[model samples]
Target chain A: MSQYELAVILGMTAVTFLIRYSFFALGDKVQFPPLVKRALRYVPVAVLTAIVVPMVLLPDGRQWQLDWRNAWLLGALVSAFIAWRFNHLLAAMGGGMAVFFLWRWLLA
Target chain B: MTTTYHPTRHGELLQGARDSLPMLAGAAPFGIIFGTLAGPSGLSLLGAMGMSLFVFAGSSQFIALTLLSGGAGLAVIVFTTFVVNLRHALYSATLLPHVAALGQRWRIPLAFWLTDETFAVVQHRYGAADASPLKHWYHLGSSLAMYGNWIVWTLVGVLLGRSFEGLDKLGLEFAMVATFTGIVVSLLKTRPMVAAAIAAGAVALLARDMPYKLGLLLAALAGVVVGVLLEGRNATEEGQA
Candidate 1:
């Protein structure tokens, strides 16, 4: 890697650490109101949805294609269903992996 | 009213470490992935381990790696990763209520280890009213375990990235997303969460082609907007009725 790349990576590492550490340094002193408290509850669901949906839907890093190639999405959907039903992390993970592997094998 | 916690000597810190050990079980494999992947990006063994020790965020590290592999601009990579990790602010806020009682010194170190696993375990304990001493002990044990698991597996990944070449085939990369799905599924106990998730997913799909991680930002903003609007409408309707 070039020196610039090395410097960039190091800089990122520092920035990430600063963000994590900032919580302890500043978050403790501040208390949020009830409305803001209620708002925070939605954050994880929002952020997680935003992150997961795009990746599963567009894994090839192109225009959003809706086809059988998106077996990953199907696998994720099935896993979501299992998770909703069982409310267990291990079960959800196992179900997704099972469907994904099964799809890959059948197609191959 | 302010309640002050009594201070303890440095020896007591070991108790804190011992308390955090149980969480290592989940973190071990996760850390290994980070370590192994870091080397392929031209990071030295020490560099990989240092990233895990200092950064300690699996998703952000992976995001950084993706940008590095793509040979994207440094500014873009940094900006994207920063946006991706903005959720840490939310996690910190969620955990503040519990650690507020720990006082200042313990607060900083406790927050340092506040990964998703740590926050989940700690928040669960915090929510339980009149928790037994065993609860805190369990959390402390888990946190320490997670920390050790992270450090050791990171070293292993850095040193042995070549040997475990096919680990990606196992789809462990998807496990991180799957974990988030599981959490989202478990937490959607109300109408607003349902609306918010759908809104976010829709925005993400719509903005899928946006560059520089704008899709994620847009999706998150959409979710927040939808949630706030829905809740506001509900409150107003309740008042009128």
Candidate 2:
């Protein structure tokens, strides 16, 4: 590994570990305000949705590919529906990947 | 409502591992895909494994790889990593109450091993009303399972990527989206949660061009604000009614 790559890895590791360990390290010495605690409840849904939306709507990461030909969008929709109905992670991923590959082939 | 069954620490640990099986499955493709891409993206084998071993956060690692491949500087890549993994802070905060009583030795490793998958399963375990004093063992179990699973799959992918071709182009990364979708759907039991998802999605769409992937952070903040406001409004309406 180049020195630059090593530095990047070390920097990323430090930052990530600190973020994960911050609260646990503080333990009972610090407590979030009530509103902050309430807001924490929505973080998972919000952050995951934020990440998923751009990935699905703009698979290319640059353009907006909102159409029938966009297999990612279609597959993600199907995946979301499956997850909502079955609440099963494996089923959702399996079903979604199936749809994604199938739709891509059909379009190709 | 008292039950006669009491699980031992070892039992809780094993149960935690068992419960994380689905998440292990979900994360497998992602880990393998990262390994396959790491080599082609100019990372040495040790560097790639070091990332999986140390960074341990899937999405941030992916983002870091992307930024690196794009010729981004170390500072930019590191800043992006911070932004992408900032959500983990919220996770640790959410889980802090349950783990606060533990010693630093336990907290340190547990915190290090925490990921989205482990958080989902371990948090659920913590939320359960069982009277198990050894729930931290359950957390340890899930953590070790995910950590080991990630390393193994990354090794598999790294080896496979060397001999095989075009594994990254197979669109297997979509598995992550599907898994995250499942998690979000399951977490959407409340109206605020549903609103949070919608608000986050909309803002992400609108803010897609933000530099250093700051859009994700902005979108999440917007969603949280919208959710909190809606929850407050609902509480007021219910009070008046």
Candidate 3:
């Protein structure tokens, strides 16, 4: 690997470790205020949703592409419905993949 | 508090590993896909496997591979991966109360081994009201199992590369979309949570072009702020009434 590649890996490892270690590193020495704690609670759902929304809405990760060819969007909706009903991660994955391929084939 | 933990270290370790089977199932496909894509992902074999060994976050790894293949700048790749993983801080915070006394030896490795799958399984173990003190072993069990699973599958993907030419084109990534669907649906338990999700999603799309994914960073902050502010207002209104 080149110097730049090594730099990317090292930089990522440092930042990732810091975020993961923040609370443990702090331990009893520091305490989060109540409001910050409340906000922290919402981080998971909000962040995960944000990450996927663009993936679903924009196939190229560049712009909004809403059309029949966008099987990802349809599959995403189907996956959401499955998740709500079944509440199984693997099952939702399977169900969504099944629908995605089916939509792709049908559209083709 | 209902279930008793295993008496021995080995027993708890096995139990943690066993209990994580369902979650392991969820992470396996993604791991394999990453390995298969790694070469085409333009990374040296060392780079591909090394990332799984070190960075260890599935989503961020995939994002990094994508940007690297596209020749995105190193700073952009690093910053984007970092933003994607910001959620881990919340995961660490949730588990801190249970793990506070474990000290660095245990806590650091646990943090390193922690992944979305391990968190899902171990969080339940930690959240349970059981009087058992072996929750850390259980945490180790799940995290280590996830760690091992990632390494083994990446190797498998590397070995299976090229022969599976159509794998990436298969649109199998929809499985992740499906998995996130389940996660978001389950977690949207309140009004503020839903509001946060919407704000984050809207802002992410609007800010996609922002350099270094600053839009995503801002979106995450916006979501948290909106949720917390709404929660505070709701509590105040109820208090006055």
- Top-lDDT candidate index: 2
Residue B186, model 1: Cα distance from true site in angstroms: 2.3
Backbone clash pairs for candidate 3 read B1-B129, B1-B130
Deviating ranges (above 4 Å) for candidate 2? A1-6, A63-71, A82-108, B1-15, B18-26, B36-42, B62-77, B128-135, B160-162
Best by TM-score: 2
Worst 10 residues of 3 chain B by lDDT: B1-10
Clash list (residue pairs), candidate 2: none
DockQ-better candidate, 1 vs 3 = 3
As a whole number from 0 to 100, the lDDT of residue A79 in candidate 2 is 83
Candidate 3 displacement at residue B4 in angstroms: 14
Could you tell me how far off, in angstroms, the CA of residue B84 lies in candidate 3 after the best superposition?
Answer: 5.5
Question: Taking the candidates in order, what DockQ does each have?
Answer: 0.36, 0.56, 0.48
Task: Output the lDDT of residue A17, model 1.
Answer: 53
Decide which is better by TM-score, 1 or 3: 3
Error of 3 at B157 (Å): 4.2
Please report, as a residue range, the 10-residue window in candidate 2 chain A with the lowest summed lDDT: A85-94
